[model samples]
Target: MNKDNLAARRAALIEQCAEQRVGLAFELNALRPSKVMAGLPLAGYVAANRKLALGAAGAALGLVLMRRKRLAGVATSALSAWKMARGALGILAQLRR
Candidate 1:
């Protein structure tokens, strides 16, 4: 937990790398501590937001499906009415002839 000791330890690590015939490059900045020593960051807000988004999407999809079913029924009824009207007109024309 002491910052001074931690800095000293890091310096010693870099020095040890040189002794082991390793090149000292900017890549050292990418070195991270082991997971056992470095605890993971909890993703609380991200998970909650993800669940909210998923629920919203599911509800939207359900609403769309219901609307589609209602539209299909309306379309079918309209087609039936047109067919009935055509049939009645044809019968009237035959009666006149």
Candidate 2:
């Protein structure tokens, strides 16, 4: 109601706002990685080994064309598993950075 009380209240409000700003900043910083990754595709992963992907594709095609059904199935499965593992490792490496 008085000048001193008003000033004190204003000071408290300012301090509270400052604290809130800092807390918000910290929270945003913590979420920065997730935010960055969200903007990226599939865990920020790309098949970097073009040669490997191409080779696998070629091998898969060959197997199919050769009419080796069982071998082609195994090769396809292995390639898929390798791709997944590579992606997971890449994500982990990026997070570590």
Candidate 3:
């Protein structure tokens, strides 16, 4: 191609690249940590009440440490119940088929 045609093609490519860069920057801005966290409901609540959330978390940790044995027994009972229910469901499904 001639010099003018090449120059015109180069200018078009440059404009296209600039447009892509701007679009990419906008997309990256949307994916930023602060923007992403702001969109989450829990994150917004925690951000609004940082002290309250921290206090609740600390209390939960303290309870878990103090009642570890009781928690373990409850967890074991729950697991047993879940397994029994799952087995019953499987048997019912097989009977239906």
| Candidate of highest TM-score | 3
lDDT of 1 by residue, 1-97 (tens): 7999999999999889886654434345345333333444334443446788788889778667777778789779979999999999999999999
Candidate 1 vs candidate 3, TM-score winner: 3
Model 1 vs. true fold: TM: 0.32
Tens-digit per-residue lDDT, 8-95, candidate 3: 9999999999999999999999988678788698997887789999999997887678677888887899799999999999999999
Top of the candidates by lDDT: 3
lDDT of each: 0.72, 0.81, 0.91
lDDT of 2 by residue, 7-75 (tens): 999999999999999999989987776666665664544334557767878987877677577787877
Model 2: lDDT equals: 0.81
TM-score of each: 0.32, 0.38, 0.47
List the candidate numbers ranked by TM-score, top first. Answer: 3, 2, 1
- Model 1: colliding residue pairs: none
Candidate 2 clashes: the total is 0
